[model samples]
Target: MKTLMYVFIVALGTLACQQEKKIGYVDNGTVINQYQEKRDVEDKFQAREEAFTKRADSISKAFQLEVQQTQIDARKASQKKAQELMQGLQQKQQMLQQQMQFEQQQLSQAFQTEIDSLIIKVKTFVRNYGKDNGYTYILGTSDAAASVLYGTDENNLTQIILDALNAAYQKQ
Candidate 1:
């Protein structure tokens, strides 16, 4: 029994001497928000949204002016001519509305696609980083949700990963 106990102790010591698994956690929101590339993408999308709004506003203003002119002309024109003019204006308004809606949808879809791509890039970068650094796992936590409930400050990789990601983005 004593020999068996010594053998068990030796086995435990051998297992303890094996390599330790590395694990880390990062704040997903912080990393994504502080990432320079994400900020650049958001800025670019904002500019596009502003430009689209301006163009839409200009078109709407021009249409309003045309409607006002048509009303004035209708007052001096024949009943039939006034009816025709009103119908034309209505058709034009409908076409303009449809065009605006289509453009808005296209812009929204494009932005969503870009954002999805960026998210994928972030995930891929984290995976590669873990593989390269020999991390068994790299959990993510956010204010809205968390994959890791508790981790020591030493195991928090958010800042380090964020800095590396930003550097890589700058090089690109």
Candidate 2:
């Protein structure tokens, strides 16, 4: 009976010596939105989009002028010449439309690729942060769905992690 009592005490002591797990959560939307690197990328993409819009507008205006001139010239042109001009204009319009579509797709693809890569970078940063800070688990919560529905304010690490991430990005 004494040996069993000793064993129980030993077990209790061992359990007491083990540290409790440290856990925290971050707000996913807040982190992504507030992250400086993401903002920078978005700003750069916006500028590119603006530039593309300007060029598209220029192309459209030029095409409109060409159509107006062709219409005026068609009245004085021989029937065959008028037909050729109309066909040429149609072909040019189709080619311009195709080019614009291709450019838009390319821009969209590039933006998606960059955004995907940034998300991966954020995930990696969070993982490394957990490992470095001795976190047993780090949960993510977002407006769409909460991975952590109930955590104390003290356990919310979104701002801390965001600040750290921004600082690291600035150093890069």
Candidate 3:
């Protein structure tokens, strides 16, 4: 028993000296989607989109009514007058189309900017979490790119880091 204890202690010491690095992994999609801030951002954009679509629909209906009225009046007017009315309607349609396109583009850009910012913020949070927790490496995996093929649940930091991140966000 004494000889066995001596060999075990020596083996333990040798293994301690080896200093194996700790590694972990996280599901990027899960972390990003489950984040409160990201959800809020998405909700905000959805509301804005709903409002914009509503307003656009109203404008289109009004435009359609005007077109119908103009068409009715054109039948009783001179040929030259009808031509003038049609030209004006065409120009108005073009302007409305352009304005709607510009507004849509602006909305899309703003949403993308917010999303991009959130992605960077998440990355930084994960990096700091890894460093602070003494993780030698924290691999990220997503549907688009699977950086971690397989990792044990013990080494999975998805919920742990996500909870910390939300707690920090709440503090802010």
Number of the candidate with higher TM-score, 1 or 3: 1
State TM-scores per candidate.
0.88, 0.90, 0.88
**Candidate 1 residues 68-162, lDDT tens each?**
99999999999999999999999999999999999999999998898889889999999999999999999999999977888999999999999
**Which residue runs of candidate 1 sit more than 4 Å off their true CA positions?**
1-19
Candidates in order have lDDT scores of 0.95, 0.95, 0.94
Per-residue lDDT of model 3, residues 19-46, tens digit only: 9898999999999999998999999999
Candidate 3 overall Cα lDDT vs. reference?
Answer: 0.94
Across residues 1-172, which tens digit of lDDT does each residue of candidate 2 receive? 9999999999999999887999999999999999999999999999999999999999999999999999889888999999999999999999999999999999999998999999999999999999999999999999899889899999999999999999999999
Q: What would you estimate as the lDDT of candidate 2?
A: 0.95
**How does candidate 1 fare on TM-score?**
0.88
Error of 2 at 127 (Å): 0.3
